[model samples]
Target: MRPSGLRHHHRLETRAVTRFEPNLRIPGPTSLPPSVREAGGRQMINHRGPEFAAMLGRIQTGMRPYFGTQSEIAVLSCAGTGGLEAAVVNVLSPGDRVLGVSIGAFGDRFAKIAEVYGAAVDRVSAEWGHAARPDEVRERLRGGDYRAVLLTHNETSTGVMNPIPDLAAAIHQESPETLILVDSVSALGAVPFEMDGWGTDVVVTGSQKAWMAAPGLAMVAASERAWAAMEIAQMPRFYLDLRRHRESARSGETPWTPAIAVIYQVDEGLRLMAAEGAENVFARHEACAAATRAGLEGLGFELFADAANRSTTVTAAWIPDGVDWKAFNGEVKRRGVVLAGGQGKLAGKVFRVGHLGSVTVDEILGAIATLETVSVTAGRPVEVGAAVAAAQRAAIEAGIARVPVAAGA
Candidate 1:
């Protein structure tokens, strides 16, 4: 018998199960490597010291490849959302007409941020779990007098990755002067995003997401066009002022007191990623997402996002019918794997499995196995073992690792 969150009557197991240090499977503040943890534990140093400058230098240089910009990158003591706000306030003024290109919840949040700051936002929406297409963006741009455009590289809520390059092209073709601001919070370092190549003016990300580091730091990179907008755009910003940050970055420092501990951890994480190679990291994330999705489908689960727009960082899916998703999620947690529950309208309708950052093949399979045990105990048993095998096979096919035997064996 297993512990059930459902009070309506479910099997109960007297054999107690204890799992320590549950596997974290959330989109941000992802699983950190031992080295990053140790780095964070180091004694505090002078934020204005030479040592700090060197550390900051290393972080900036190492992270540039992933940010896909030769331009300056600024690290702020803020999360990804803060970075998005900074991008908006710095580039556009109050009542400035902006186009919000939304695919899911996060994209909606991006637009709301602009609206809150007094930007007149006109949104172009796509169905939940589906990405915004280029044709739709071009259509929106055709008639609007937008001063800036807001886009999200990855929609964590619905597990969708938009076609940013194509969208950028359409925006450029229709409204070349409008600043393009992108939220790459959960996508950078884990997916293919070339900011400079795509001609994006501003792109922002956080240290916690695919950086495999702790939270408390947001990174922003800007092209010359965005910096030009910052010079004239006035939105009464003080703490998030990028002009001050830009000047400070030249001196290898931040405009304000930074998150020194998270910075230390980010330095280590960036070091590891640099050694791993950017292309390799992206490949691993893609392979892991593929394997996780295949495993979920094998277990008789339906994916929430469309296959054509599925994200490589997280996989969102509906729990099988006849099983309370909350109860099923609790079982997974009790078994030592904490998956992220959905939010907003998605709520219990979906569960998200984050496979980005440092997630490995073994971790995915272990979580699947735990879900299998819980599902069977819940009386909705499926041959999840075969699904586990499918994941292993997919990994092998992706050149991630070799499998001893297939699931049927």
Candidate 2:
């Protein structure tokens, strides 16, 4: 006769066990590549030691080409919000007037940050899921004694990519002395950001999103003009000080203890991206986004963003008639896919499908398949096989699917 514990073990072994599958979807803090994930498991080192300093040096050097700048790039041990704060506090004095463009949640946060610093913030607000027009921004700036204009390059909340270059041109023409600070958290690596070329003074981004690394680290690149303004700015700061970061980074160091694990991961991610080439990396994101949009359109879902300004990182789709968003999303979750939901007023009315960073065509197609099946099961009819075909067509037309491997590989 078997022991009672042995019988229980046998019974447990006979039952179907759930296995964890890695996430292949979601906008950011995207599935890290194996190399990047492995980098984090390395032995932790002293933040002030030469090993960590060397690591920071390499990261700063790697970030230059990606940011399209020769200006100083600072790594802060905080999230994207910290980068935003650094941008604001490092460059502006109390009672300075600012014009903030708000098209989504993140943009709203910029305005709030400005207000917190005692800056008189004037908002050029637009409906969520829409891009703020350059003319509107120009018109607002004309009315105020604005010291700087803050813009969100990609409003992740609404899947809208604002026309930053155009807005930059408009701001320069109207208020050349007014600094231009951009929150590029969702767009930086996935899209082109030419800081000097575009006349942008300060640009901030996070390690997640298009960088394809774990969250916690924030990167900010500031132009010479922005740094010049920092000289007279009276806003108080210590750890988030850009000047301190710049001074230390010159010798490959940080003011405070840095997140060594995240720094290692960022280094690996940047290495992978550099190997692929920056333009190629951006093109990959564009292809994924275009395919995603095409797939969604083919399925007959209405887009929340204007077609021209849709973000190349995430796509927001309106829940169709007769399909319950709750049930549809539930099915997606049940099938091991997670999607972002609408924010603020659009909550429950729209759902976001992220196609940024390391996502591939097959993975996106799988998501489309899941979405189509769930919509159909919930009584919404999507044209059979249409989404996948459209996505394929878009990918092929963009020449992204035909990317040539490097000679060695």
Highest TM-score against the true fold, candidate:
1
The lDDT, on a scale of 0 to 1, for candidate 1 is 0.85
What is each predicted model's overall lDDT from 0 to 1?
0.85, 0.84
lDDT for each residue of candidate 1 in 1-409, tens digit (9 for 90 to 100):
4445753343335332676567788787787787888888999999988999999999888878887789888899998999999999999899999999998889999999999999999999999989898888888888778999999999999899989998999999998988899999999888777889999999999988888788899999999999999989978799999999989978888989999999998888877776677777777777788788888887878999999999999989986667777766776777788888787889878889998777777888887777767777887758748888988788777768322111111
Instruction: Give one digit per residue, the lDDT tens place, for model 2 in 63-107.
Output: 887778998799999999999999999999999999999999999
Per-residue error (Å), model 1, residue 258:
0.5
TM-score of each: 0.93, 0.92
Q: How many residue pairs of model 2 clash at the backbone?
A: 0
| Model 1, TM vs. native | 0.93
